[model samples]
Target: MSDPITPLAKANIPNPKDGEIVAVAEDIWWIKMPLPFRLNHVNLYVLLADDGLTVIDTGIYSDHIAQCWDALLAAPPFTDHPIRRIVVTHYHPDHIGYAHSLSERTGAEVLMSQIEHEKSMALTTLDDVAFADMMIKRYRMFGFDQDILNALAERGNHYSDKMTKTPDAGYIQAGDRLTSLSGDWHIRCDRGHSEHHIGLYDPARRIYLSGDFLLPRITPNIATPLAAAVDDMLGHYFAYLAEMLTWGDDWLVLPGHDWAFHAVSTRAAGLIRHHQQRLAQLLDHADHAPLTVKSAMDALFPMELNEHERYFASGEAHAHLYHLVKQNAMICAPDQHGVDYYELR
Candidate 1:
């Protein structure tokens, strides 16, 4: 079913400058933080509590970001107000960046899903050689060449660069209720973008603070990393999309990136169709001959990619291939050379 039109126009949303807080609702502030990537920025929300402030999603750790947080938190309205807690939507570097540091600084509890917390801790202690070895094997199976394999190995231990410390987080599961200044926020966990991406919804106000699960126009990457090999990532994504379609169309969607939007059910349907098209394209491409994940990745995303981007590219291709196999629409198996290849069933 189609969704109702958004009450607010897209052009009506205010453009927030770096570190500048713009009120989305009563006492709820949206803060955009800068990032050194193609995506450019992340939106962090500050919620006013009776005693202090509750900060959600800390941007990556850096001297510049630190300065911005210091100045913003020390300014009026928040000058004497201490940070009550640090809540993360997921384990991604950008979302959980300064979680550990801020928790230490404010002595505030860090809250997130159990899997996100465990994964964050696991990545910190994960052995570099073992990780590199596993990545090399997976990449090689997906048809990566020797030179690219060496480059992937050199990429080594990426978690340390983005996250400075391990967060000792308190767990918040699906269906849990959190009391905020605005109203009672219910936690809903979805998988596809991450192992356990958390979404906060307030039914009374019809607002959803969607972490990367829902974005304005940009579709969140649906990749399956090694840790999520057993999970049907794309299947989970489609189910979650269907559920979002049932939400009241009037709810304002506060996403992790870009601007806040309202036509959520429309956006959810669009994302469902987007993945369906990608899956169809993969099937058509493989119909010609057995295709490697690398070949499928190139066909689906033709742009030149850096080493880091290549990781996501591989993951995305793997997601489609794995999902097709799960649905019995494609055949995936190893060849004599030990590389995995797919063909239309």
Candidate 2:
């Protein structure tokens, strides 16, 4: 089947260059920071109000980005108003990495969902070797070879090494409302990409602060959750995308990565169809033979991948296979040789 996913279009505004802040709205500013990956930037926002500025998702901690932040903070709006709250949408390194440092420097309250805050704390508490061992165990179950597993383990805590420790934070839950001069943002929570990811919506402004939950271009990574690797994570992702279809097309999405974009409902529909096609692709392949996560990953991503990409690809493949299992459309057909497969009947 033809994949419904296409290159999602961005809003007709200039994307901010690295370290340069652009005005997203009358009182909101956009700061794009460079990342050391293929998708090489993250979008952070500052919401201005009479009381102070509210930062939404601090960029990952890097000397260059930190220096940029220090210089930006020392200037006009921030210097005068000061930051009152640092709202983190999730616990991803790129999202919450600089939260602790920014809060320390600006005396801003770092606010995150209780589940996300706990996950952040766990990341800081777990040492590199321990986290790497966890990865090895998880990937081993996904049918990765020992040699690749060892290589991946050496990359140890790549997520944690990028940032400072998380500070104590206040919690925000689903249905919570944060009212300010910026607008009345109604907090909505969704899971799949992460255990509990938060998005803020302001109907009046027609804006959605979609923190990796609804990226315009690509579907967010729906990997196995750390707590339960076998859970049907992709199912949760599907449900969230279905919910987005009801949100109407008025939103100007401020995503965690990529430039701002319009048409929330369109993007959501495309993403949902994208996942459905992927699941069908796997099921069709399984009709020929029993499928393992490795086989599915290869079929889904028909390209040569480096070590990190391979690991992520495996996780995404596993999520889909397990989702099929959860829906009773497939059954696990494990081999005693320390690898697992699934058969779609």
Candidate 3:
């Protein structure tokens, strides 16, 4: 089938520099690597500790990233000390892609939040096959054509090969203090973006490794189709934002994407404001007559969207619309074709 969206190569974003490590702090390095989506790159962190090296996140399971890892493992700094543990911030393929491979190569234990580990395991199970099919139907209900639906399902199944083989060695919970990698890093867990999104905080350095909780440029998506109970992604997101504001301005934020920066408080405020603005825009565009979710999505992201862009755009639009409906600001109705329609309440 012809791809609905242009391939990453045609998107014109620069391929990530090969195997270059940017130092975010003393003994803490950021390894920016390529992702096969509209988002061009993801930042994986590495820390040199007294015990052994700790890799915070692994890049996508692509040949380029594999080669980059091979080079890094064979290089001076990384070669000197073996990796002690492979710690994943979340279950997202971009963050945990090469984790299994790295563990196999170095005999490193893979540590992740219990929720993340369970979700990852479920996605690759036979029981998940029915769920995957149901997801395809749900996307179709949102007005996506068969071609796009197929692509989405294919991408979903692709995780079986990309993720690590080892089960989580240990589960890290919220408010837990980790003393392995650094002196003491606090674990903060939030929902909405991913099932068990984990962030690390170093009190001494005043640094926070925000997996996808607090990105600098773009807002982390807060939509979950696979949530067990009520899927209140926007609610989870705003609550997380409130939690982030409790931090001091002096805290340095090392996000999953974008460059590391200071001003965590300000960034958290800006993200909250951005969501408010978006919700207002959506409400204003939604009139008395019911509007399909796709119409609302186009109204927000009017630029010509390729397949890859549409993937995220559709999910994001659904997230905002779902939030509005829950807040009683909007209503969801279905057309005869079974497509969902959103309207102002």
Please give, for residues 18-46, the per-residue lDDT of candidate 3 as tens digits: 46776555567778877766777888888
* TM-score, prediction 2: 0.94
What order do candidates take by TM-score, descending?
2, 1, 3
- The candidate maximizing TM-score is 2
- lDDT, candidates in the order shown: 0.81, 0.82, 0.73
Off by over 4 Å in 2: 1-4, 227-229
> Could you tell which candidate, 1 or 3, scores higher by lDDT?
1
Model 1: ten consecutive residues of lowest lDDT: 1-10
Error of 2 at 150 (Å): 1.3
Per-structure clash totals for the candidates: 0, 0, 2
lDDT of 1: 0.81
Q: TM-score for every candidate vs. truth?
A: 0.94, 0.94, 0.86
- What's the CA error at residue 186 for candidate 3, in Å? 0.5
TM match of model 3 to true structure: 0.86
How much lDDT does candidate 3 score? 0.73
RMSD of every candidate to native, in Å, equals: 3.3, 2.2, 5.6
> Regarding lDDT, does 1 or 2 come out ahead?
2
